[model samples]
Target: MSALAPDPRFVSQAPGPGQRSPFLRRLAHASEPWLYSAPALILIVAVMLVPLVLGISYAFRDVRLLNPFSGGYVGLQHFHELARDKAFWGALKNTLWWTGASVFLQFFLGLFLALLLDKPFYGRGIAQALCFLPWAVPSFLSGLNWAWLFNPVVGPLPHWMVSLGLMSQPENILSDPTLAMWGPIIANVWWGIPFFAITLLAALQSIPRDLYEAAAIDGAGGVQRFFSITLPFLAPTIAITVLLRTVWISNFADLIVVMTSGGPANRTQIVASYIFTQAFKKLDFGYASAVALVLLVLLLAYSMLIVLLRQSLLKKG
Candidate 1:
């Protein structure tokens, strides 16, 4: 009798080189994820990487805004100058306060809004739309509106404050250094709150109703359920949002630059405005670039800290 032929259908397939398993083989060739993200990666490289490289190059050289001169081989000069400059330090301090305070307030306010909106009510859609309107407004243009609204002489807010006997005179919020920082923050927060609210609201909606129902069956109240169940699930989202907002607020220059022009004695100038001033106004192109490099480094450090914190939290869970 002839040798029986093996059935191809039941044959053992040899493992391909570099493939851990058949599952990985499918994943290795999968087009869905890469296709979905290819555009974003290309866009980021073009928009983000190009500017980053330019900024870094300019930091090393004296490239004035007007002249755009290539200031060559300054070596630690700009960094040293930044360390000595009071304006830089002041701007940094204000930036930290602005970013921290605004993020904190935005988080709580967003959490409150998200919680409130999670419960269905009349006109909920309209209310949510109105709440998110500030985000839709152009940030720089919002600065203009806010600047006028905070104007000492004519803003309706100050008038109300005066009428309420909070102050005998309409205070120039943008003129006082302490209040000046707050002016930009108020605008930034208004724009930022809707972002958090929307993000958190989505997360809140995704929570299985069964969890809440089970909690209710266990005699846990809304607050209790939130503390135990809701907070735990939302922690990662909140952390990510806070870190993102920190990065954003730290770099936020629009409101301050537009509204106060880093005035009230450079009290409102963040790293962004400071870099702008160094590059444009002072014409210290290389020095400004160095300051920018420092800011970028600091931002990276901050992001690293957040990553560490996230890792620690994950380990705990």
Candidate 2:
């Protein structure tokens, strides 16, 4: 009998001399993901990483905008000056107040609105749209609008405040050092509440209706269910949103710049506005970068703390 022909399927299909090596093939396969993400990685490096690095480097140099030849390395001189700078210290204080007040007001109001909108009601869609309208407005426009609203001569808000006995007369609160901070804070809260509302509303909708039903069957009241179930479910979302808003608000300066210009007596001058002042008005880019670096470090520390706390809470849970 003739020997059976070897099965082609079982035969070794070794690479020809012209074919790629196994290692080269594996390498190419491994690099596919990187190739796919190359555009995003490149964009991140160009937009975020490069600017971050340059800003850090600028902190150690004297980079005035007007002076082309002023790029000398100054080490920690800027930081030392920052340490002694009373204005910087004041601005830092204002930053804490501004961030705290705006975040607090925005979060609570947003949560309230979210809770309201979550219920089955008439025209809920329209109500939600109207509530979120302020957020859709550009921040610059919001600032300008709020500025106009607070204008004693042109706007009705000052007159309304006067008639409501909130003010003695029709006066621009933005011009009062004592009350100037509140103008921007109020505007920021108005613009930012929608962010929390949108996020919290989404989180609220994700909650299981069955859980609420179960709680009700177990004789839990509305408040009890909210505290025991709703809050716990929303905790993670709240933590993350609060952290993001805190960071964003800490860096926000548009309203202050457009409305008050950090003026009257620099009462509304947060660190972000201070950075702008140094960078543009003072033309001290190096110092501005140094301030920005400090802010970055502070925000990083804050974020790490929040993350660690959340992790601890999760572990305990």
lDDT per model vs. reference: 0.82, 0.91
Residue 175 lDDT (model 2): 90
TM-score of 1: 0.81
Best by lDDT: 2
State candidate 2's TM-score.
Answer: 0.89
TM-score of each: 0.81, 0.89
Task: Mark the regions of model 1 whose C-alpha exceeds 4 Å error after superposition.
Answer: 1-47, 65-70, 305-317
Candidate 2 Cα deviation (angstroms), residue 148: 0.5
Model 1, 212-297: lDDT tens digits are 99989999997899899999989888988888788987887878778988998888888898887766678776777788888889
lDDT comparing candidate 2 with the true structure: 0.91
Candidate 2 lDDT by residue in tens digits, 44-91: 999999999999999999999899999999999999999999889999
